[model samples]
Target: MAEMVGIAFAFSYIGDAFHGSQIQPEVRTVQKDLQIAFHKAKFAGSNPLLRFSSRTDAGVTARMNVAVCVVKKSVWQKMGDLRFRRALNDHLKDVVVWAAEETSEDWNPRMASRRVYRFRLETMRQFNKPHDEGKLLEMMKLFEGTHDFTGYCRPEEGRITTRTVDYCKPWSIDGRLVGFEIAAQSFLWNQVRRIAWAMSEVALGTSSIEVIQEALGKGEQPPFFGLGPSKWLTLWAIEYEDISFTDKSGDFFENLSAPPVGINGRQFEIWQQSADHEQKQLLLNSWLSYL
Candidate 1:
């Protein structure tokens, strides 16, 4: 049997068009697109098996995600890292391959050191009232330490619910967009969204801090607080030790560092442009209605 070689790569996706990161039969997904690109590039055989660091749900964008796959040694020698990225990008539309490197066969994305996810909340629309920053901060503190988040996540059989949260905090962006950042080694299904839901309730005065405390004490699912919309959430970054990646675009440092203003600042600028255009069109339509 021919020896197998491993390759690791990082990619980003808009996620609006994907059902999820995992491949599902009869549905479009990031994994499906990636597999097709691998085949088109001839980097892997027909049965290319790719493993991802994290599985993001529908409508959740990722700024940086990691994936690893093992292929025949001959294929790796032919394609190399640069050519593989270039060929993969040609077959992808919304997904872009930013970095690629060779790795040992035993290396996989599951060994990632840490993962960060950011949830953006439109407080003005969701709360319909002024937010209390102090109270929100108090709620955020509850999520920092080790806790059984069974109540804050969808239950899965044979899975442990107790997880350590390295950091969980809420901050304001431009005074309207509320951003919640969560960092951990891993997360349960729907964990971040549910935590955002509970915190929003506290900020809006619909629920008190004691409610979250009680849920933690019980270590069971809390009373229904609607899950935050998936569209506003993004997988911000994944971290790993002993691995250095060279950007395919040759702008590694510029892209890796957070901009001087911040990530939300850049996102808000894009959002505001679309919002302003829609507002102007609506005003024009209203004027035409009178005529």
Candidate 2:
């Protein structure tokens, strides 16, 4: 019978595989693949739908990205079956459909209470030597509270360009690399990558915290600055409050049939990409040298 089941899957998609994350009739995407697999398995059609919490850039990777989809009870019941797991693995190999499970039918990946993202830095891309990551972390002082991240993203976003960052600080994953973990209820397109660029600016004495805040306060488009290769930004994790889960699965799901329409998110990512290319490449080169 038809039922709303919150199924979350953690996976990876090589940046080169498709034309970004959303499904387009003219192109392929992670969403398209998920839909295909479900369609082939007979669990998706008009009744069940899949939704993602965040959309990473074409070349970006995720360490803890999340998505939820409703599927037939029969498919949900078979989630633990070894063969089913293997079958999914076979179809999703390089894309990595690593985990799947039941969640509240009302689950929304975007509405999560908090999201943690890690920007992994690989030092010395050319000579392969590790630099003093400590020197690179002082810029983090500028990220501690709510600020207008407009300087870190594009101006074409259909919705409000301002956002609040719960916490952001830089740290060393090991002596080899320095990374920054940013936790926020939500982020704008290219926000994290650009902030990384600001950090790089600080390290080089090309800029300062005042510069960063001045930009944020002024709502300027992030100075054509973006960070290392998309590979470095990973969606570390997405968390939800336990109270958001409910026993009334059917009713809760029924309420999810239509997501609000007028306010469109993801509108600025397209423009942000063009400007990010050079910014990311410059940082990648410098970042590679850090190792």
Candidate 3:
């Protein structure tokens, strides 16, 4: 049996590099490039094969994404020892495979571990205005532990609604919008997007905690269809206890210096000014509609 190799990438290469995460006949994709590189490198002097854990949308991103491939240990060492970042950039710069890690013949990226994601939202409209960060935190507290997130996500990551969410809560990010982190064994497609929309509604007082709580069920009349664009959700990390994220996923600036707080403030103000004055009045009155 051929040995399996696990690969990881940053999500920034979505629509620009390929059509999306999914591999299609007419377009380029992350997985395709990896396989292409392997073949081009003649890692085994044969066509290279690879697989991704989850297929992301056109614009989606990953901080610690994962992919798997198989090759002989000799070829694995040759490719693994190669300076992947410079090599890939020099030869196959189109798709930046900055890192690579070797795994046993039986390794599986998706089934062996959990995933972590971080999402940030900037209140760009009300740049300098103060937000009730405490209220946002309080509402997010409601997401902790196991709960039905069916209302907030698309039905593609998985069909089962009973997910044991290890972490769900919001924290301040720069003075703009709240940032939330989620860690779980896995996720369904668009799950984070749908949750972000619901959480944002709650923050703006447009929806209640009960609305989110009530929507957790997978029964008839599930949660609201996802809101907002899919650009904001970033797959921050993928885990497989069996495989060391560091060894398999490669280096992710996990310890970067603090982000620009000023940029967030400016973006927040911009987002606020973009809001309609009349619409604000209607939103104020319709606040009760969330009930």
Using lDDT, give the best candidate's number.
1
Q: 1 or 3: which has the higher TM-score?
A: 1
- lDDT for model 2 comes to 0.58
The numbered model that scores best in TM-score is 1
Clashing pairs in 1: 151-221
Q: Candidate 3, which segments miss by more than 4 Å at Cα?
A: 1-17, 84-87, 123-131, 156-158, 171-178, 217-224, 246-291
Error of 3 at 284 (Å): 42
Q: Write the per-residue lDDT of candidate 2 for residues 127-206, one digit (tens) a residue.
A: 12223445566556566677777678655547687777787776443333345778888887877877776766655556
Which ranges of candidate 1 are over 4 A from the true structure?
A: 1-3, 73-78, 171-177, 244-291
Q: What does each candidate score in C-alpha RMSD? A: 9.3, 13.2, 10.5
- Cα displacement (Å) at residue 264, model 2: 45
Tell me the TM-score of model 1.
0.80
Give the TM-score comparing model 3 with the true structure, all chains together. 0.72
Go through the candidates in order and give the clash count of each.
Answer: 1, 11, 19
